[model samples]
Target: MADVNPFYLGAFAVYLLIVLGIGVWGYTKTSDVMDFWAFGQEMGPWLATWSFVANFVSAVSVIGFIGAVYGEGYTLMTHTIFGLMLGTSGLYFAVDRVRNLDLLTFPDIIASVTGYEVARPIAGAVLLGNGWLYLVMQLVGASLLVTAITGVPYEYMVWVIGIVFIVYTVLGGLVSVAWTDFLQGTVMVGAVLLALGYMIFDFGGFTAINQQFAALDSAYVHPTGEGAYTAIGIIATIVAFFGTIFTEQNNIVRIAATRDVRTAKLHLAASGVILSIFYSALVILGGATTVALTTSGLAVDNVDSAFPVLITDYVPTGVGIIIILAVMSAILSTTDTRLHSTGITTARDIYSYFRPDSSDDSQLRVSRIATIAFGITATAAAVNPPGTIIELYNFRAVLLTSAFLIPVYLGLYWAGLSARAILASIVTGATLGVGTEIAGGLFGVPSTFIGVGAATLVLIVGHFLLSDTEPKGGTMAGD
Candidate 1:
């Protein structure tokens, strides 16, 4: 069993109090729903970029990601690299486009560009489904870490984190979440760097870590190897990258929330560098765990759990306090923001389209309900904790690929991207994504690619067939 120390308890308590305090402070003066959802368009570069990267690299990477590499080797990192790069590039394409539209949600992006009333609601549903699935993954990931550090039951941690997040979110809205993320994100980044540094020295420095990696003949670290990467893994990564950036609401909402096209682009530039570094560290840390563990002969099956297990096993109680803080920071930073995203996505994009007369108060109420509902759903899914972190991570990428990839690009870039064309593309992609998942178990090849592959076809075919509208416009948000 895991022992919960006093220093760890005190550290987590202080972190929680500060977070709650900021949320309450922000809530006291929120002007409206826009303020609730987008911090009233008030985020600066530092706040916006930090919030983006923090939310981007959460519990999934910290716990789940490391676990994934431990099981699958460095090949997992390849998919992530491609997905990350493509995802960022995809965002860069849209930041300027969305910024100019000044949209509240991704649905706003769909409706503004597509000129279809129906696309707004459908897009919202697509976003909500994808966002909530990924959000639950984050929630479960956080809860597991909390339980390990605090000796609380996973379920209790889930509800505790869930309720606390809801309080500040419902109270301060985006104002509270963004400001709090900045503070929490800082803690998480600092702690991870510190932990990694300690790890480097503990192994007698980078020379030893590298020599161990090289001796092991781990092809996963060789970023240049192509064939060592499996066909399916690369496919999984490509589909995830193609679909997620455009489809997922969290990334898009951040983009849309920006003040202008230029701001959104800068946000992307900042996020690309920060997010890549953070994710790569997880891979390196995962590799290092083998050097430490294999020599010791511990029966470790899961890599994601490696970080937690390391703290308890090798690290002293005092130093473990920092790891505990990192875990808690990861849990709180990701979970609260996710609760905020799902509730808002469902309310603003999905619910409002169906219920235009819905008041801001009613919307706020619905947002809270959605948050609770998502938290409950995640708790249920987490009970099983199937496959690995990498498997779960791929789910979002899968959904994003089928539904959003081509439609997003065509919708944003090509003037011929009609609402009908986009809707068709979404249906086709979704069907293929579902098929890929089903086929993978039996045949060992993913069905998800069918949707993305066909959608790209649709993107090409749709352009010529949909031809020549006089100029609804060639508008974009910024650079």
Candidate 2:
């Protein structure tokens, strides 16, 4: 690792200070739980759009996916980018209905759609689990970057970054998160473009870069790389990513927070466009890193460290810091959103259900407490993450999509689903999702296909068998 640059440390400090300032400002704007949880449903298209983009494009995309591309070639990018764009387009179909529901949390949407009080807690649990794992992924990616750049111990950097975001989240909730996301989103775009341009120029041109990368190893430019990626894996990756967009609380909250359905739709469309360009650039940059490292006779022990190593040792210091800040931006932007959603899911979905008469003030207090608790827990987990960043992300996405995709989306438009069916779907999906994921996809079939498939089958079967005899949970709240 390069020596710690004082200039980089100074710039990082200033950035953290700016983030804290934004949190304080967001606190001033927040007057109640509504403001904290949903930005008071006052966000316009611009802020909502950027916030959506920032939250979706986390450390996983910028750091994890980039590393995957560096190691695995463009196959990973093809599946993930296609899945993401397809999922974003799917959001357009649900925006008007989802926004009009006026829900505060994903669990609330589930509860409202199912009319089963029990469904709220089950959905909340799934959400919290998903958020915690994803939060750890963000922290792991950020900690790696900061550690490589500043030579800070990874364990200590994990807590430091975790505590900073947790404090702001406990202070301002979504208000702080949205504004910071907008800023972070802009920085992320700039950083990616800068890195991409540098790579292009350094290697002569796009074609030359690919030619050089191919010279090192044909597999570096091969579609499947070293054959680690299979046809089944690619299909599963797409389905998992696509289904995740429907159930990801962070993304759903942004849509619900928008001023109107039109704004929400606009946010989704714009975010999708920006993310497409941003991710494509990252794919190019990943290939460039391969060529740069090989030509420079450098090697990284952990593939996940490829991006940080490239920026810190290969790129100019000024450009490197910008990309570093972009990594920080990606980390903080996603962490705060996950922390906020986890808190809200705890307070509004689970806590409030047990105490239905709890005042808004009471729920808000619990929300902050929950945020702090989860933040600490996630930070601890990040110190020794359970798996690679992308592996952890895939697990989170598969579980959430399996558990919530069928019940939430189908319940939105269909009215025949019973509480029993919804509950069965949640339980079955989560169980199989975890089991299949742990079993490494059950004979090359992705956990997503099995879990979501089983969930859908169970829901439909349960509905047909039980809906006629059992009482429906009543129509969705808005209906």
Best candidate (score: lDDT): 2
What is the per-residue lDDT of model 1 for residues 373-451, given as tens digits with 9 covering 90 to 100? Answer: 8767766676666555556667667777777767866677776565556767776777677567656632555656666
Query: Candidate 2: where are CA atoms >4 Å away?
Result: 473-479
- lDDT for model 2: 0.86
TM-score of candidate 2 against the unseen true structure: 0.96
RMSD of each: 3.8, 2.1
lDDT of 1 at 188: 75
Q: For candidate 1, report its TM-score.
A: 0.90
Model 2: per-residue lDDT, tens digit, 83-194? 8889999988888898898886787788777777777788889899999998899999989988888888889999889989999889899999999999999998898898
lDDT of 2 at 26: 92
Model 1: how large is the Cα RMSD against the reference? Answer: 3.8
Candidate 2 scores a C-alpha RMSD against the true structure in Å of: 2.1
